[model samples]
Target: MELSFLSSPQIFFTVFTLAVSVFLYIFIYHQTNRRKTNYPPGNFGWPIIGETYEFLYGNSEKFIGDRMKKYSPKVFKTKVYGEPTAVLCGVAGHKFITANEEKLFRVWRPHSLQKLFRAPFLPNASASIPRETMVNVTRAPGFIKTEALIGYLGKMDTMIQQHFNLHWEGKQKVQAYELMHRMTATLSSRFFLGFEENDPRIEKFARLSDGMTVGLHSFPINIPGTVFYRAKKAADAMRMEVQQLIMEKRAAMSSGIQTQDILSHMILSSNPAAGRFKSEKEIATLSSALVVSGFTTPATALAIIMKYLAERPDIYDKIRAEQMEISSSKKLGELLNWEDIQKMKYTWHTSLEVMRIIPPFQGGFREALRDFTYEGYTIPKGWKVYWSVTTTNKNPECFPEPEKLSPTRFETPPPYTFVPFGGGLRVCPGKEYSRLVMLIFLHNLVKKFKWEVLAPNENMIGTVIPMPGKGFPILLQPLST
Candidate 1:
């Protein structure tokens, strides 16, 4: 009787059923216990892949906004790029994470990014300089701060003039995006690497920049045909080029051929006795990051500002008038200076409005150093957190009639509400640098020409930064002298 029962198909089915029931009971119990720990309320999507596809492929603002609507406005849980991530929204979220820098939270970049940037020990490592500190040092007084910034104006002016002569002047139509990209690239090279616009290596840097931007937010796949793989390759090439440049610059410095740009500064600081010293490799890594970050945002912002100006002739007239007033104060052939940049108040305000209307970067990431609670929700350790300027900047509570491009709204607003360059301890060090460059570009642009947007209603493609749909073509109308 026992042998016959064992051989029966029904008995086998019964055994399988029992096993499944036990498994389900154990799983449900574990999940129930985990839920009791009170992690933040929201969906984590599928295992591994998570909502990363939706976040990357779709509109960043809408994606986060919809989530905020569905879940808690302060924070929500979603996994992206194979990591469990919590997105922190609004003013409170921005303050909480930014204020807790290096305490309960630290900057986090994915493995793919760490590899691409060639920062072997990032996030937190004893041997490495913290990213913020590194950036702040690189942006100190003689680097990108006021003294160094003032010096860059003439060089930037020369580059812009060259850009207009080469790409804009005498041309019926020029792609604003392409021209801005080149101009920004040239400016970055001059300021960061001490390279002239005509230097052959400038083209190489620019091309590699394109590859790096494409890969910044892509999937971490490193397969031959993948965007990440291509980006890594480009980074590798750029890294090598930078290393050579550092060596050359070091040699030049040793021979008393001093250079005033960032690379030269880093070389001088490489002394072990100097608390702010960085090794050649470290210097190169920072320089590569600088090139990518330095140009992309300002270039994108400049293009968008130009587009908005073209659409609003009244606004354009005001900016042009202000710029002409500044130009009139300067002698012919004289370049802009620090004082001139400060005087373009209206032009700068207009730029702020454009940034608020369409931020160049949608958001940024931070990682939890320890488990923390936010608005009564427990955020576990080893989790990634995000803060979006877009979320807060567009909130009607923060900005009345948030969609409007009224610069006057900036006359008075809630503190930490409009953070185009981010805020708190982690605020972008290049804020002033970008501001100076933008004002210079605008002053030169409006002084020399008036342009009409050829594609006013074109769609915008959002990546790590927003880009014009049609490369933002414009018909140049040079202003009469």
Candidate 2:
């Protein structure tokens, strides 16, 4: 039978509508089945978005605390952009994930710009930078022959001496955080890419890269006049600069010249299978990552450390004595080495305590991959899980008198209770490096100058990292030789 022209349109519309209806029904059914059977209860805030709005605007910490009190240490389920999430609180919950980390915890894929910023060109860029690569580059070593811990110590000492001369010369009063950021940027560039002081690109890259932390939580839309847009522009400019450096390094390598920077190491090292080393893009991206990860944490920690010292004059005196003991036998302009830092165990402990109290990445999120049962609640697959390192550190049971700033508590605190560097396979690879930086800076600061907080009553604000609103200024007095 011949079909009428009008009837053909009617049939197509009816079939399309029917297909859509069936698809909708199936999707709804699947989502309904995927819903938690008896998941840990918590507020979802608004529909679909769940607690994302609260999280984005800085209420997540308080929200998590409130839920912990009401729900009592369980997996609190919620959603972000319609994605399911679970937040594990209390000692048991923390232990469960850390113990079975490989299975229970996964690095929630970092936001897109993270992947773009890490390795921009790959189609599957999100997955392109392997966990193994990150572990190797950020941590110690793998098939690639980056320096181990001791090598890091040597470099750190040299960098510390240079930084001291640049910023802390003759007891000048400086903004601790500002000096720290500049020093770290310079030191990291010198250590990572072997850039000289005259390399203007380092300062530009630092400016752009620092803004990236702000971009991570911003809306994904890169429309003109947006923060993300500016970040992307900055990233592109940095990338171009890196490309130029890579070409220069490659040419230098071709001529059999070996430089002492990370770029030279990357160029010379080969993959186990005899493949040429990491691409210039990869090197540049990784170089940027190293700087981004290292710069802020140490700078923020140094600021906080200064704040604590300023508040407690007694502790300041004790630390000063310790520095003097280390420096008493050494001459001016002599570099303090790794062995010297190791002698300042008390300083290390104090820094550790400060981090526990104020972790840089305060709360981390992970998404569930499969249905999981916890405390009579079934957390279905695809739920985003948040673990608050800050709040957990404050738990009274785990840390007696948790609010008090006591470094000695770490000498014997309940195991797994204080994870400022996070836990699991994803724990920060730069932990030891950060430790060395903080110890070295504190050692010198205490020895050279007496400092007191300019505004002890100023409130600290929380962002991706926490810092005092008034920028931790201190009145500095030079010590007599």
Candidate 3:
């Protein structure tokens, strides 16, 4: 009654051979599929898993660079997060993505991000608010205008001065990263929702925002007790709190209140295209998002700028001299104006140079609107596209002596080589806000304290936003002006 002679004596061997063959077949199929399609040169790695593990845990630069070396340098195909992605490298990639928004591509928030925004526990108001919706509201009024920005300078200067007066002055040592993060986070609460400097709610807002940010760039492992789960819960609480604030602001405005914060502005401003004021829900959505996302970049920039200042005293002295010159012209207690900011060119340049060497965000991802061809390779419709900043930011041809920490490179940067805030209609309006905060913080810093980096070669982690490994402790002393 045996199926065959071998089947009777070698059941284990037969089953083992079948499993290995199936595994090899799947591997070979995925590997060979690149050639099978009109796709770009590169393998998709193993089936199901793909190159995702390496993409997450391995070196980001090397991940792209290794493939570029082995395959065509222009474009390559790979799978990450269970999606086929086409990575476009260098300035050409930057130009193409920047120019082609809504034409051939669009902003592609990860499913995880979308899920975070629309969690079940959160209110349904945000469900209708797309990323583009926020952009439209940004153009409506407030925050994005130069007049509004100029008006904010004094408040920022005062806020930062007070921040340092309490947090920095007389402190023997501090974690530079934590210090900057606290400053920026508090600034976001005050600017966006008009929270007072010493409000207990500011602390609550910062803690909740930190919780929400934990899963923005992480995977969607939404189990009962995962980080993502906690992030979702934090988002719910944050949205509820912001909605309550919006309700209060609306009532105050109705009764002839005249306050000047981003929330009040949004409450009164109308979307010109729609010719109506943004709904309370819409205003709440934008305010909550700004509070959560606004502080991160400026905070990171300040921390890195300070780290570099400690490492290079010559740069520090140069920046300090510029700040001193500006201060000399101003009366004591006078806030920094647009004119003073313009004069801090070298200081701004230093920040740019630091950004070039270590960009805050590597780049953003986009989804193909339609099938497109670039560099003789086909990028299929519905595929994900990642336009990298690291590729162009570090390009030697674009930046001669790219590795050098030279702020003067910005005096005549190569055309379209580095755009820290992105370009075109897709450009983030928050960039101006970040610029003002970082420069104002620097102005206060150079005028106030000289710090020492406790751990110069401290290992940094995180591919997008690198942070010190062991710790980022620094010793501070007030400068005897």
Candidate 4:
């Protein structure tokens, strides 16, 4: 009876249909996943923790270079910063992320950064401060207008002049890191917040900034003794203090007092894109973000540039001549204008090369919004993408004699390769602003003095923003007027 039942036409038909359906389903699933799950060739390190120790505990370049040697150079898979990371190496990798942003990827701050600089300073899970306001206040016609920037040239020139008069003019010996940091603080405090050259805010802000910057690259451990904890506390305090300053500025502005600073302008401006003026709290947060991003980097870079210039007289002479020519064009007691800054091409290139060899800002991080393929390897959705400047900055193919310093290399560097300020929509909004300040400072520095680094072979200690290991003690020889 059982055999007869199995042999029935109805039973046979059902059995055949089920088998075909199963076969087709398996075939389709395998075909789809074969394309989707073609993950890049690299290990995730260990079980839950991944390769976090090897990645963070040693020289990052060696860690990355070793992986590229073991796997493919273009892209590789590993877990870092508590996420599955696709480290994009070389010029192609840098270009890929810059070109494909918003399509396959979006700006992603590390969770550590998010926890450290929460809302107002940075919008939750956002890549940067409000895009429109940051752009408008930085470069747009309505806000700190192009002409307004021209006005700032005079102010900056005076500040640099005063800075030298106070610090660099009479001194035979100085520490590059401390001096550059103070110079940066002087400009940032005065220009960003309208603090005077002698204001105490510089010291306070410096303290707050130090605490936060030290923890920027630390793991997000919130224990009382950890660096991350101190960073978070400092960041929180900075937010409160900045907001207080904003409140004071807002109250002052309401009474028809004259105020001409970045913070004041940010307060006065309305957001055309967002269709409303930013609140004081929002403005405070954005201002802090700008100061934090734009502040320390220029200082570190200036110190590095000084070290290079101190070591290379040919480079310094070219810059010295450029500044002298510009100064000759100006009348006695006359301040430098925007056009003078434009003529500093050689000086600018020299600075650019220094940045390339030792980038202060490094490259940024992004999140993959969806599954994407690059070089025939799949980057799964939600995986973090690391686009690096260090990898491309030292490529012998793009830069001939990668270890050698050559400012002329800037003339021939291929696109998306020499990214000191990074590239694409997420590029440093402070690029123009930084250029203005750095050039002005350099103009004064190289013109008035030729310095020699006492420790000519100072090694860098930090990675995120590389600082001279020895603080770059230098002997300053003043130029006769």
Among these predictions, the greatest TM-score belongs to 1
Return the candidate ranking by TM-score, descending. Answer: 1, 3, 4, 2
User: 39-131, model 1: which lDDT tens digit per residue?
Assistant: 777777755587888988798888888999998888888888888888888888877777898899888776556666754434344222357
Cα lDDT for residue 1, candidate 4: 44
Root-mean-square deviation per candidate? 5.4, 6.1, 5.0, 10.6
Question: Candidate 3: where are CA atoms >4 Å away?
Answer: 1-32, 119-129, 265-283
Error of 3 at 231 (Å): 2.0
Residues 302-328, model 3: lDDT tens digits:
777888889899999999999999999
Clashing residue pairs in candidate 1 are none
Steric overlap count per candidate: 0, 5, 0, 0
Model 3: lDDT to the true structure: 0.79
Specify the highest-lDDT model's number: 1
Off by over 4 Å in 1: 1-34, 121-129, 271-279
RMSD (CA, angstroms), candidate 3 = 5.0
Worst 10 residues of 1 by lDDT: 120-129
lDDT of 4 by residue, 1-481 (tens): 4446565788989999999897887677446545646788787765445787676556666777788889988888888777888999988988888888788887766666767654443334333444545676766533245566777778888988898898887788998688778888778878778888898788888778878887777688899999889988888788788888888887887887878777887777756476444466666666776667667898888888888887788888888998999999999999989889999988988899998888886666788888878899878789999877778777778788987878887766689787777678767766777888899999988778888778876777666666788888998888975
Candidate lDDT scores, in order, read 0.81, 0.68, 0.79, 0.78
Model 4 misplaced stretches (Cα beyond 4 Å):
1-37, 120-133, 136-147, 269-281
Better of 1 and 3 by TM-score: 1
